[model samples]
Target: MGRPPCCDKVGVKKGPWTPEEDIILVSYIQEHGPGNWRSVPTNTGLLRCSKSCRLRWTNYLRPGIKRGNFTPHEEGMIIHLQALLGNRWAAIASYLPQRTDNDIKNYWNTHLKKRMKKFQTALDSSLVSNSSSSSQLLSKSQNDMNSTSLRSCSTYASSTENISKLLEGWMKASPKATTLKKDQEKEKPSNENTNVVGTASSQFTQTKVEEGECGVISHEELENFFSFENLNSMAWEKSSTDSTPQGSLSSLNDRFGTMTEVKERSSNRPAYCFSDKWILDEESGQVEDLMDLSLDCCSAPIF
Candidate 1:
């Protein structure tokens, strides 16, 4: 009955090998130098069959064995070698020294086989399409060829127009461009104050440029544009006007503009003064004021 197996299947272990078992196997092979699998189980007292022990050593436990995904060159070599060697995986493994026969066989069946099938189908489809198109082209007359060329040109022009319109619409509707436009509009007045500074810098830069057309720019004038004094003034203005605790809502609303509009609106608002009303209790002979003294935008006190 199949030569009664190698090490008796009754007590032999199956499935994946453990790290400890792998270490034991590797250590024994390092000392003994592989081969003679029949005595390996007996000598090491391992629960594996002789065949299992041999496979574990050759496939995994081997010192120079490489793991992980195969490279493109390795894949191509496997495919070509398989074609030449057929299903002789041991022969293929001999060429790829780092890979085991089992690994090559498994990879071929799982990955390479499907890839080759897809390649073959794709090649067949391309050939069929080429043949049909070529036949149609050959059968077409000179007039039909001219008409086809004219139609293609028209379609290409139409496509170009559509693409141009789409690009124009995209540019106009772009959020970044819209935001930049709004920011530019908002900063127009602020920038107006900076234009005098920019003009002076520009004139100085132009004079420097005229003096040394090929030389490096002097950075002295540019430094003045970003001077600490200018930066301090800008910071002070922003902090005092924009972030001031005493500033009214109108001041906050007109932050982008000069404070003139805020001052004007505040001055035009009518002053308000609230008075207290008293209730007389005839039975108790007492008078109670029901309202609190209040004033809004009024210089005079309300009592």
Candidate 2:
């Protein structure tokens, strides 16, 4: 049999910590610095066990610990690290300066993991379809752009202008915790209203040879850029939480008057289709799903 447990439960205080206890723990650590856990309660005059004291301090009361939502870049990093390190929270926390091991663990369990399980079936089909047809789909987007005129629509924003603006918006906007329509309308930057729809000479046209140009878009490149595809064989589940992808995709065929297609299918939901022209009349805002949808880049309000 194992040795007796470290502390007796008979008189030990338990449950949520009190303000007085928190103050005592803080004072002791500040006075003498954090050392052995077994000594914290003895020296600090608190009723919590050493283990409890240590956990409380490390996970909650620790200085500089950021308690809030994780940013997209940070979320991407966490997903990448977790893939590499498994569930090693401490190892994962090292890369995130302000987050604790407990915090990252909790976030993974409560938010991302559950969503991945929910969408596993749909993602299996989307992943295969998208990975194989990336080039063809993009070529179609280019052809459509050439044949179509610049049009603006919202409810079904399939026009070339709408696609460009929406793609640009995702590239430029900050990652939000909420995707509600009202909040997004208020948050959209007014300066971004410049029409991105134009010929190959359009400012949005991208070139790899140019310094600022992102060149063409590719899932292979994005897979590498994201650096965490395995997701423990749940690789099917991409970045669903904190859906902020870095940089932006430039049409690889920008030199050929082409624009790239947005993956309409997210692990979260069905994707929207973007082609050169809208099926609707010039002024109509309603969108009809076109042929061959892939990933869904959060576009302008499709209300």
Candidate 3:
């Protein structure tokens, strides 16, 4: 007779596990550790079979478990490993520590298997066409040859195997070639740093000449230009000019005309009016809006 099951099938729940059951199982495992599945359902009072409990923990609830779409790098690894290992998903999962054997199997069956099959079909067709053309060329070569039997025994299957091998070799060698090139570039810069230093000095001299041409001002000159004395003199001159009746009228007109000029600047939309009077005046229209709201509130009777 076969060995008895770990847990009886009778009275065992078989659907998706509830959150409460998960929490209970996780708590029990945390306290007592994960092995000895025969006692887990008995201890935690979960209605699941031992197999289901173990699968849930290993596939989903286990710590450090990664659950999401696989990355491209991971997809490549899975395809390459699958080609090498065949249907031994457990062995493949050992290479991908984050992925479970079940997940890897499901993903391969659902996604990668179809893609690889389609690609294999295309590759076979192309190889067949290439082989037929090569056979024609070989036959022509044999006909041209005198008294010599020339045989071309290359098959489509052999050609496909050679191509796969060539791709594998290229994949292995590409990284090493890139690293060697990068090292050569890095060494060149370090060995010829004198040119870099010379270029930097030349750039600094060019900047100095540009500043001279642009009339660069000294710090003292800038300070004198914005001095308090200069400011007071300018203010006195402006005040004296505004003291005249015509100048006062012209200044007032200019102040009032600024809003219209701003409006005219943007013909498609109305420009907002902004002035010192609107900002600095204490009695603006804001008080009226507040008063209107307060009056309405006081006049209305609340039930």
**CA lDDT of 285 in candidate 2?**
24
| Candidate 3, run of 10 with poorest lDDT | 270-279
Q: Write the per-residue lDDT of candidate 1 for residues 1-303, one digit (tens) a residue.
A: 467766567888988777667667655765565689988998998999989999876666653444545654456455444543346577566546566788778777766565554444443454566443322332332233234223322233343334334434543666754564464344322322223222222332233233332132124532442233332233223223422222322222333232343343333221110000000010112111100111111111111
Ranking 2 against 3 by lDDT, winner: 3
* TM-score for each candidate, following the candidate numbering: 0.42, 0.45, 0.41
- For all predictions, the C-alpha RMSD in Å is 39.7, 19.8, 38.8
lDDT of candidates 1 onward, in order = 0.44, 0.43, 0.45
Report the C-alpha lDDT of model 2 over 108-218, residue by residue, as the tens digit: 676545544444533445455654544544454434333321322233212322333333354344243123323434432232221222111111111211222223334
Candidate 1 lDDT for residue 201: 25
Worst 10 residues of 1 by lDDT: 273-282
Model 3 lDDT per residue over 98-195, tens place: 66788778766655555444433443454566443433433432243311112232243243334334433543456643564454344332223223
Q: Number of the top candidate by TM-score?
A: 2
Q: List the residue pairs that clash in candidate 1.
A: none
